[model samples]
Target: MFHSVCQVPTAKVCGDGKPSRRGRSFIYRLKDEDQVPQQVCKLFFLSTLGYHPTNDSLVLSVMGKDISTPLAPPKDQRGRHAPANKLDQKPLHEHIESFHPSVSHYRREHAPWRRYLPSDISMKLMYADYIEKDNKCSYESYRKAVKSLNISFTQLGEEQCESCLLQEQHVKADHQGEAAVNCPQCEKWQIHKDSATGSRLHYQSDAERDLPEDTSTRSVDLQKVIMLSRMPGVKSAVFTRRIVAYHETFVSVGKKTNKKNTISVVWHEGIAGRSAAEITSAYAAALEKERDIKHIVYWVDNCSSQNKNWCLFSSLVSIVNSQTISTEDITLKFFHPGHTFMSADSFHHGVEQEMKSRPGGVVFGCSRIV
Candidate 1:
């Protein structure tokens, strides 16, 4: 069988004696006026010399007119050049090829990563890189570089960082001090309430004999500690009554800044009765000697069985109305369940920690722990 074959163009030597038959054949095949135009070769050489096709030449080339003398864009009936239809124009990549060198770097560098990567994925990767970039790089430097290079970059806020979100999700306890710092009530109490209490305390100390005994307002927190019940081997329940009194004395205050001063701690064993009456009686007995105390603000958690019941309310009212007691007005403030950590919780935590540090990690009796 005989095989038919087509002839391939033989390599030709240019003026520099470099052989390139492929380029020559392609140029010749264009067949300008049955021969390749001299300007075609000139333009090719110019392109090789890094001369880019100007906008004017590109417009003419796109319109299928010769680049040497590009025809003016046709005008409409209104005598203005008709705007090119973007839908009919070449693709962005083609336009990039025609763009001048001045802006070529911009177009080449900024091709969006979203074109290849999914938008969400690209954004996350960019944000991660932005954060973990040079440790010493300034914000302005990175931003300017991003702009110049056309990076697919996203800037996330401090809280929006992946590490920050992970940390927040894992956080177990609330920072009470930081929380208190932002509270307006806590701020005012620190500056005003504590200052007033200090003044009253000073006045009482300086002129206790001269001034007649009257009444004053006191703030207190009450909590029940049951370590006495959880004795080493025995499991009999004994409640350890913990009362934290806030006064204007120079004593070391607990962790809770709102509970400004630490006065005295009174503990009533379970033997004394764990009823509402017993609790109120303990509070009354502690303040009864302070005949000057007229109003009292008690901060406690809203445990209906213990503090918020009608029994406790009635007992407070009876004290104010009682002729024997000097207290006139009584206020009960209930804090949020888990967040009621100001004085009562602080005292409870301290007692529990101290008890846990013992040899057996348990408290047998109040006397042993105290």
Candidate 2:
């Protein structure tokens, strides 16, 4: 039955202008002269082979094959030899891995798993270095390998010292002169940078010190003003005016035990502005909670209108003099204007992350942030 259904009857070409290839080639008929319609023939052929009628081309190909020829086994290429031009990735990967010694690793104090490379060391520079070593790999392959390793570059902080910025500008200006060797601006810039570095080291030393049980170190900073009415995935929300909310974070660290306690005071712009009076009030409230400690050291930024003003000082004096407060000594250490990245900033970062992860990213009121 299968042979009868798939039989291809051939006929010689009879009428031709010349004895070309087409004239000599055998012409095969798809069906017998009295067979069923082409569609029904296809359906019958497919049904016998357990194939759908939609595969008419396949059915035609099979039916058109000469029955005189025997079927040959398919040539399997599995387990064949690898291509000669295929690259050996082991050496290239080792070269890329060698970059580990050149770059510094920094782990986030809050999230230890979140490691980062220095901001200055970019992929382009690393790839350039790799090429200098005569490594044989494309930049794209190197980038994929780095990405697979979960290596990421650290972003620059939001705040930078104004003094450092000015000094940089001055140094650039001094370099254009004929005698750039002994420029006073270069000396001054170096002094400013040294001062900033010293202050940061001193703050770190104080924070890491193991002190008496009666003393505690606290780092305080005002977070960036958060805008409310943030609705994610809403196009119109971008144009609307948002309410501003102020957050003051105080991270109290136990010098001896290395324990941390974070306190956040949140308020909207309608309640009070970020004036010295408001800041002093917040500081007093934070201090009120630490009355049990005999000595408290505060690390703050050098913002005269906020932490460095006489208003905050007078307020602190009043708190210390008040009989209700048990604090015997209060010390306020100010970090350099542009280099105040402290524990409070980390706390604010955590708060920002939490706010972003809220359902629908909808923040209607200031209380929602709390």
Q: Which candidate leads in TM-score?
A: 2
The estimated TM-scores of all candidates read 0.31, 0.56
Query: In candidate 1, where is summed lDDT lowest over 10 consecutive residues?
Result: 246-255
Q: What TM-score number comes out for model 2? A: 0.56
Model 2 RMSD vs true structure: 16.1
Backbone N/Cα/C clashes per model: 6, 1
In model 2, residue pairs whose N, Cα or C atoms come closer than 3 Å (at least 3 residues apart or on different chains), thus clashing, are 161-338
**For residues 101-192, could you state the per-residue lDDT of candidate 1 as single tens digits?**
12211122233232122224443344345456433334444444444444332211111123323333333234433325665544544454
Write the residue-wise lDDT of candidate 2 on 1-370 in tens digits.
Answer: 2343444333443365443332122222234478743433545656666777566565345444545665444569876998876767777667656666222111232344543455567889988888888777788887887776666664324555566667656656766533245878767767776787798789879877787777878888888788886787787887888888888877864354765456667788989989999988888877777778898889998888888899999989989989978999899998766767777766676667667779355332222222
Off by over 4 Å in 2: 1-156, 169-181, 234-240, 253-256, 359-370
- How close to the true structure is residue 70 of candidate 1, measured as C-alpha lDDT? 39
Which residue window of length 10 is worst by lDDT in model 2?
101-110
Alpha carbon deviation, residue 100, candidate 2 (Å):
22
The CA lDDT of each predicted structure is 0.41, 0.68
Clash pairs detected, candidate 1:
214-292, 215-292, 216-292, 216-293, 216-294, 229-238
